[model samples]
Target: MSHRHVAAIDAGTGSGRCVIYDLTGVAVGSAQEEWTHSAVEGVPGGLDFDTRQNGALIDRVVAAAIRDAGLGATDIGAVSTTSMREGFVLYDANGEALWACPNIDGRARVQAERLTQAGISEDVFRIAGDWVSLTAPARYHWLKEFRPDILERARYMGMLSDWMATRLTRTFFTNPSVGSSSALFDLNTRQWSDHLFERCGLDRAIAPQVVEAGTLIGHVTPESASRSGLAVGTPVIAGGADTQLALLGLGRKAGQATLVGGSFWQMTVLTDYPLVDPSRAPRTLCHARPGEWMTEGIGFLSGYALRWVRDAYFEPILSAAGSDLEAFDLIEAMASAAPIGAMGVVATTGAPMQSDNWRQPPLGFIGFDGNTPEHALGNLARAVMETGAFLANSHLQKLEELTHQRYDTIQFAGGSARGALWPQIVADVTGREIEVPVEKETTALGCAMLAAVGAGMLDSIDAAFAAMASPIERHINPDPERNKLYRDIQNNWADVTMAASRMAECDLFEPIWQPPGAKFTSMTDIRKV
Candidate 1:
């Protein structure tokens, strides 16, 4: 095969990014487009995105990445796409998109209820693994029940990655990475669930034919060639969800784990078999590789929590700043000053922080006191970071039991990753040696690697990761002095968080609670120092 560079297009929750990677996996160029997701019908939480607008932006961003690479798109060996999982656009027989509702859109609550009423809902824990939430099965069922006319017109339904693959190659297909997030795919069978389709009244045919993560779907057609600057007939590969791709990019294997410290904070560890946790189900996604799954212990907050603290709790500090740079400096300085334990601080909240449980309000400072940093916000910042570590560790312990493997190190990535202090804090708080990637934006690199692997430019996913992976930026060894403090705090925090759920158990929307707390605490105390 002829040599070719890899191009990655990521249509994500917050923005769109196109990146070009050389054969060695070093990034040469990239471009990004950040768009605001306006609520449909001008109502609150009626979340939606313009698929066409995002689609056009992908086309433009790819062109920019190519231009920045000092080569035309035609120079690229292969193209692959990655995206946030579970959202889909309905397409007519002619490939026209109906309204593109994002995965978190709330318009389908009633539709979801209908599926439950139809006995379509199983134990959620047994058949499907973990928190089923608005996974693809429910999303497709929503269309069938609420928007039947559109459902009738849909010759195809697809995730953002699959849709882009279709746009580039004019063929509808899916890879295991995307399929794992869809409730339609049975974790045991590694194929679409006939039972789920029959109960939801969904046409399995509307879903694309499933393939492995590195499969080449087709070549770029002439129309896309003109718009994207990629040559006509250029190979396009079907890749994966952004998070899963990032896991692979971080060199995570079935026995290892990686953590992301971004808008959404998550820890993904490789598991030989799927774990069954009803409460943790919403956060879990099956692995793309057959008989291998990723036991993801994640939450919806982290860096975004920091952004919230800056805006709400610390808005006065931001407003008094002379400039943007000065304001950012002040925030960092505050985080630096905050002592490790945040001085008896308990819980620092942000952005509703919805789990499988109650809808907590935005930005709550629970267990506040006179000792709490009032004007001095360092305590709050430390608590926020500490909360992140504690929460992350919360999931890791469960995953270890489910996978029957222990993680020696945790890999870090994303915007918050630039802060060296956070890694040490994570290490001290979680008591794990931290590995941070030198090259940031690994999600982009992961997609490029997938494209290369799919294009047959690389032998296997492991080989692709080897070719594209970078050296570790820095290492943060856990401080034995602080580890004891963090361990006590982590135990208290976990138990307190658990105890407080009883106050919320009365709420209709909360997750069903079970006891014993999952043994995450023992792992903290038993860490090999």
Candidate 2:
């Protein structure tokens, strides 16, 4: 009650970190331990990482953050974690990860296909408010059927955060956001489903205990404290998946929506009630907002698509002259060089030009006659950004059918949202007024707020966000002129999508994957080929 503090062990695909937040929802201290994700190229490429190493990174960074905060483990009030979802760590009785699988490692598509074949997926979706995914629960299916040997030694298959929480508190529990990612939990009941358990051939225990975010899970154990450098008795809260954490950091309340525009771009509108889509692009997930859930419209390739253009095409000029810190400086300069529509050079969002089926290729060139990189660069940037916006717009229209609500303004937070020009373009393209929060790392703030609620410093997540939240600083209103032009571009992009879908139906441009044999042991084994 004296002074409240919270900590986050952010387990990312590439790194793990310990972040400290004060009562005001500001980061007081932070420390990072880098990790790597290994991949074998196919559709998603086999995105794999060393789970044990990631856990070690968590221990190292937590110690560093405690030291940086000028406090030992005992001073912190509570701790929670935000982590990459879908990857499950199989545990033995000793709480050690016998083995693990990364999320959407591009291998579970077959299992997802199998679920589709069984016709039980639709039932799972109707009840769980989750679509069958090539991750998490489907992963259990793949493992149980394919790797019976490994399953013999495995007991619990929990997300990275759940495993870490169990490691700290000596109790196994799951957060709402993480459980939703499982594709097995009934969003309405907020618990595991007998329907899904039987469908996937998974055990009921495979469903971890669901805990509401901001619940006081427990204190760190002596063993965890010894290694993590936090006090053994420091309270730990049930945090959530990183996106939900980011949503919290963004100060999501009952009504406000969040735009997470990192490598992938997702726009979410929250409601306690969720509507699920099976065949279409707009998918829904449980929101980090307590008593409420959210519907997510995601674009797989947003920032990464633009980065590809920056590298494969503009690297010689941009890289030699500009760095990532200064990337926007160069990109904006280049964007300004091009005209409004990049001389009719249309950009795409993975319709016809689906590279690895994630991102659309560079903006299709129409009138490329002696245009410099500066002139061409903006078109590519605009195209990718607009195409992404158009895709999000398509989803927004679809999700409105379920929410019976519309977002008047979008709160943009991400690396790309920092750019003044791109944000305006996003606003103009989406035709919605965009509000940029004071802090871009809303996910971090979101996680910390949940932790605060768990620590009993705040009664509710909404109250914590409302009391701590401030007004937006930068705002972008849709320009009448650019909005009109982008509308036309959006129409063109729709035409492109229709054509691509048709071709895919015709099987003219199809790709096939014959699953690798068990000979494919590690990501490394597949990578060397």
Candidate 3:
């Protein structure tokens, strides 16, 4: 029988999911499981990716998805993978897993400082379009310093998605979209940079072969087929980074801006050229589509912050609801009932993106009146949601300055876009039209598009998207009065966050988040470029 379906495996920061889609882009089946990366003992910000455990989870999700589709494994024509970027896995000569860490891992502070102090960070940023903080070079140096034994036996390094593709086909290869995030690729060349390895004192031999997304890598091995419920000889395709792939699935054309809001909120603008910010405030990564590049600014843990508020303060509401979706709906309804400024409650949950000086103030709510409904949970939640919009507006301003272009409309995707209230808030805060697609899981859909291309069901990545991608389901227009109020509120929020950051500097409070090696000696040093 002719194969007419494709599968996508996605390993995200907080979860793992498998989605099966037919040639027409319709999702036939899906399964998802939440997972966590544990912090390493004695390491301040180290988060370890348990390969053995996560691998099992991946297997279970894939098998469950195929079963949910009510189709035989042989029906899947191709498989592709995508994941949270920056996280990587190491392998020994015999292909055994050595060590792995998630994207949020920050065990290499000293190594990152060494590179920065030596003035090598500028060179890496200039070539790779990324900083040294969470990239591969610093992590490799950390291994060399603290875990030399493991490094000695390691033969290859691959990103999380690359690891998934390798497990299926037993082929070690990486694509530019994720590879560029490692600080090991030459942005212009879209390949591994030998100079970067030499400068970082890392072995060049560990670099994997660079391939473009949607390229056919190899056939799935029998062992992987048995474990994942995939057919042997199924084609495995190289996939790109999650954000970039999500852009592809959203049909983002050149000169368009998109906000991907999930565990982290990424503000990305597509450009025809690989433009590096001279100030190094934003990150640049290769797009899933060849000859394209994306300048990105990130809001740290925006979605996670919202989740914390829900779990910590709204458990009663959650218990009363039938499902998480229902709970979120109720939360949105409450937020909608609150006035625009959220009753003067300013939430400093997310900071504006600064790749070179990444940090966040302590997550908090300020200026609430306990005597009035200003202290209500609905107002607090609305303030938290508004912080995400404030951060997005900040990033969009920076991107506009860098690109010398103004975006009149923005494409919003990811988990946050599913809520009508959040999207409207974003539109009002940014004073831009917001378009949300029918499918929120654009990352997995983009990976499936690549699978379709690799399986010869589509002519190219663009063709696959044109043939299968969903159309925009809704458009949100900013209310003029609300926009004016948000503009004033955002300014006050910025001032409050800066004061909070100073409190962290004084040791009176702890930062909600900061990258490894990020240090600001004074208030002036903490300012964005």
- Candidate 2: where is the Cα deviation over 4 Å? 13-15, 32-36, 40-45, 64-73, 278-280, 307-325, 346-370, 497-529
TM-score of each: 0.86, 0.85, 0.96
Ranking by lDDT: 3, 1, 2
Better of 1 and 2 by lDDT: 1
What is the alpha-carbon lDDT for the whole of candidate 3? 0.88
Residue 398 C-alpha lDDT in model 1:
64
Error of 1 at 279 (Å): 6.2
In the predicted model 3, the residue pairs found to clash are none
Each model's number of backbone clashes?
A: 4, 12, 0
Question: Which structure is stronger by lDDT: 2 or 3?
Answer: 3
Q: Per-residue lDDT of 239-318 in model 1, one digit per residue for the tens?
A: 78878877767766677888876666777876677655554432455665555776676555566677667776567756
Question: Which ten-residue region of model 3 has the weakest summed lDDT?
Answer: 520-529
Give the Cα lDDT of each candidate: 0.69, 0.67, 0.88
Q: Residue 520, candidate 3: how far off, in angstroms?
A: 4.1
Superposition TM-score, candidate 1 onto the true structure:
0.86
